[model samples]
Target chain A: MAVVKEEEFEFHTGQNRPAGVPDAIQFIDVHKTFGSNQVLRGLSMGLPEGKVSMILGPSGTGKSVCIKHIVGLMYPDSGDVVVAGHSIPSLSDDDLFELRKKFGVLFQDGALFGSLNLYDNVAFPLRQHTEKGEDEIAEIVNRRLSEVGLGNANEKMPNELSGGMRKRAGFARSLVLDPEIVLFDEPDSGLDPVRTALLCELIKEVHAENGGTYVVITHDIMSARRVAEYIAVLWRGRIVEAGPSQELFESENEFVRQFLAGESSGPLGME
Target chain B: MNELFALPREWLAATGEIGRFMGTVMGDVWGGRVLHFFGESLRQAGILIVSSTLVIWALMFILGLICGTEGAYFLEANGAPAYAGVFAAWCDLREIIPYAFGYMMAAKVGTGIVAELGAMRISDEIDALEVMGIDSMTFLCATRLLAAWIVLPFLYLAGMGGAFLASYIAVVQQVGFVSSGGYLLIFWEFQNPPDFLFSLIKAMVMATAIVLVGCYYGYNAGGGPVGVGTATAKSMVLNLVLVHLIGMLGTQVFWGNNPNAPIGG
Candidate 1:
C-alpha cells in the first residue's frame, strides 16, 4: 500500500493518439475512488482499433477497474471514458445496455453461470438477444466451442473444467456475440507458464482472424511482450508511460524500465 | 454515538436499496422479460421443492402432533375432550402451519438463495451478465422470486395437509383419546375456505419477503466467500424477524374481526 505522491507519478493525462488510427476506446482524465482510497486518478490512454493493446500494471493499480469503466460497469467519479466513441457515464440505462452489446469481457474466473453447462453458457447471449432457432444456436455455439478447443466439453459444468479449460470456454462465450471490442482482465492470472503461453498464442491467432480491438489487462510481462502491439504501463493509479510495445520496452523512464525489466529497485519501492 | 446513528442510517439505506431492487424486478416483470426466464424459474422451483418441502412438512407434522396431544390431555382433564378437534383444526389451519412454514422457508429456501446468489456475485457472474447486455436482475433475482411465488402456496397447502394428518394420528390413532369419526366431524365442522385462503396468503407474503431479503443481501455481497457466508446469515436473520412480523400482522388483518368458525359464536 505504497502511497506515492500525485506529483511524482508522471504520465500523459489525455488520449495517447496513435500515428493514423482512431482509438476504439479512450479514457480522458478518468478518476475513480472507493471510499477514501483512490484507485484511478487522471488516467488516460487509447486502445487503437483492430490492434491488441495490453494495459500492463502491478496488482492493485486499477487495471481491472479500467476494464470495468470501458464496459460501463463502473462509472468514473469525475472524468470520461469513451468506448467505441460512445461516452460512458452519460448514457441512459437503455443506451448503456446498447453500448455494452459491442463489448465481450472475459473475467479472470471465467464467470460462466454455474447452473448452465458449457454449451448453454456459450449460447446464453444468443438466446437472450436473438430469436435464433435452437439449431442455429447449436451451430454457432459448437463452432465457438471448437474455436476455443472445448467442443467436446460442452456438456460439462463450469466446476468440472480445469482452470485453463474454463478460461477457454469463457473466451469462447465472449466471442459468441462477434463483439467489436473484447476486454480480457487478467486472462493469465492463475494459469501455469505453459498454459499462459498457449493462451497468449490462442489470443493472437484469434485476433488475427477476428481483427477486433482487443484490450488485455495483465501484469504478466511475458504476455505483454508476446501479445501486445501497444502497451500502457499503469503505476500508482496513473500511467507511468505508454506507447508502441517495442518503444515502451526500450523507454528511458526509470519506473518503466524497472517494471519491464522486473527489477526490485527503482522509483517504485516495495511498500 | 456514531455507531448508534450509523446503524439506523445503514438500515434506512438498505431499505431504500431493497425498494429499488423490487422496482427493477417489477419493471422487468412488466416488460415481459420475466417470461424469458420462466423456464429457469420453474427449474429453481423444482430445486426449492426438493430442498425445502419435506423439511417443512416434517416440522409442521411434528408441531401438529405436539399440539394435538397437549390439547387432548388438557381437554380430557377438563371433561371436554371432544373440543380437541376444534383446537387442532384452528391451530393447524390458521396459525401454527403458516407460522411454521414461514420459519422453515426462511431457514431453508432463504439461506439457499442467499448462498447461491452471493457466490455468483463474488464470482463476477452478475457483472458478466451485464457485459453480455443481459439484465442480471431479471435473469437472477426475478426468476428466483417468481419461482418462490409460484411454488410456496402449493407447498403451504401440502404442509397443512401433513399437519392435519399428524394431528389425526396423534389424537385418534396413536393416543386413542378420541374416536376418529368424532374428531373428523368436529374438524370438518370448524374448518372453512377463508382459513385456507388466509393461510395461503400469509405463506405467499412471507415467501416474497424472504426472497427479496435473500436477493438483496446476496446480490450486494462484497469481500469474498466469508462475505457470502455473512450475507446468508444476515438474510436468514432478517427473514426470521420478517416472517414473525408478517405472521402477526396477517393474523390481525385476516382473522381479527371475523374468526370464520362454525361454532365460535
Candidate 2:
C-alpha cells in the first residue's frame, strides 16, 4: 500500500483467517476503455483486507467497473486484478471460479429471481453449489432469512417484497456462502434515509457478525460517513482523493474539499 | 485497407490483445453444485424425487393405456384376437413413450432453460452471481439440467399413457373385440423388454443433449430480454429438430436393419 502524504489507516473485521484469508483485492496500473470513452485509466487501489472500503464517486466514475475487474467479470485492457491469492489474469476458468467463491456481492437492484420464492432464492446458492439434503438447506435458509429479519417473508417472491426487503434479501443471499469479501454496488440507491441508516447498520452488523471484508461503492456522502472505515474518492478515472473519513474530510486537497462540500465549480467536472 | 487496423494502434499506442482467439473450447464439463444448508440440501434431494417420479409415472401410465388400447384396435381391425391391443402396447410403450414424446419434453424443458438463463444475462443478475463468488453456470445449469434429466423421460411416459388411452378407445370402439381378449392376445406375443429399455436410453441421451445445448445458448446469451426470448425459441426449435435427427440417427446406428431388434416402426 502506498502512503502519499495521506492518512495511513487499517481496520480489522475481527477474524484472522490466516491460512484462508487474503490481503487485498489488488489492481496494478489497470486500464479499460469503451470505444472512444475510457472508463478506467490506470486505476490502482487496494481494497483493504476486511474493513469496509467505500468507493465515493459521482455517476459513471468507474466504481462499478473497478469492482468488476476484481471479480474478473471484465478483463482490464492492461495491468492486473489479483484477488485473494490468485492473480486473476493467470487463473483458468475453474481457478477463477474457485477464487471467486471467496467474495459475496450485492447488486443495486437486488436482482432477485422473480420465479423463485424468497426461500428458494436464498437457498439457490446452497442447492447449486452443494449436495446437501433438503433438511439441511432448509435450516441454513431459515437462519439466513431470519438473520435479515425476513424469516416470514421466505414464501414471498421478489416482486411481492418491497425494495428495501429485496435488497435485504440480496444481502442474505450474499451472506449465505460466508464469503471472505462482500461487495456492495450501491447500497444506498433507492433507499430512504432511515432505511439507508438501517442498511448501514446491517452492513456493520454483517461485518461484525461474519468478520469479512466489505467494499461499498456509493455516491451517497452520508453513507460513506456512516459505514466506511476507509474511503477512495474517484474523479476522472483517477482516485483524486482518499483516506479515513475524517482525514479526507479535513484534508487540504481542493478536489476533496470541493467534492465533500458539494461544490459545483471546482476540479470536479459538471459533466 | 489493412492499415485501417493501424488506426487503433496509432490512437491507443501498442495495444496488447492478450490471449489469441483459440478455437479450443473449455471442453471439460467440470464441477457441479453442492447444497450447503438444510433447506437447500432438502430442495436438491426433492428435485430428483419430484421431477423424476412425477414425469415418469405420468408418462408410464399414459403409455400403458395407449399400448392396451392400440393393441386391441389392431386386433379388432384384423379380426385377430386382441392383436391391436398387443401392437398398441408394444409400439407405444417401446417407442413412443421413451423417444417420440421424450423429444417433446426436451423441447418443453429446453425452452424453459433458455428463458431462465437469458433473463439472468439480460437483467445483469448473472453478473451479480459472479461477483458473489457463485458460479452461475454450475448453479443454474446444473439444477436445470438435473430437473430436465429427471422429468423428461417421465413426461415421455405420460405421452405413452396418452397413446395407451387412445389405443384402448380405438380397440373398444372397433366392431367386435373382447376387451380382455386383446390384452391376453398381446401378452402371448411379448418378445423382449430391451425394446422399451433401449427407447428409454435414447430418451435419456436426447434429454441430456437438449439440456446441455439449451444451457450453452442460455449461458452465452448476450443481447438482453429480446435475446433471451430468441434463445428460448431457438432452443426449442433446434432441440426438437435435433432430437428428431438424433432419434433417426440412433435408429440407424443402434437398431437399423437388424432382425428382432427393438426398433421403432
Q: Where is model 2 chain B poorest over a 10-residue stretch in terms of lDDT?
A: B17-26
Candidate 2 reaches a DockQ of 0.42
> Candidate 2 lDDT, tens digit per residue, A83-174?
87678888887778777777778888788877789998888777767789999999999998888889899789788888899999999988
DockQ of every candidate structure: 0.84, 0.42
Docking class of 2: acceptable
Worst 10 residues of 1 chain A by lDDT: A10-19
TM-score per candidate: 0.94, 0.71
Report the number of the highest-TM-score candidate: 1
Query: lDDT for each of the candidates?
Result: 0.87, 0.69
Evaluated on chain B only, what are the TM-scores of all the candidate structures, in order? 0.92, 0.67
Write model 1 residue lDDT over B1-265, tens digit each, in one string: 9988998999898789888987787677667778977888898889988888889999999989877887788888999898789889888987888888888888888888888899999999999999998778888888888888788888888888889999998899877778999999988888788778988998898888888888888888989999999999888888989998998888788777774632323
- In candidate 1, position B46 carries an lDDT of 91
DockQ score for candidate 1: 0.84
For candidate 1, list the clashing residue pairs, or say none: none
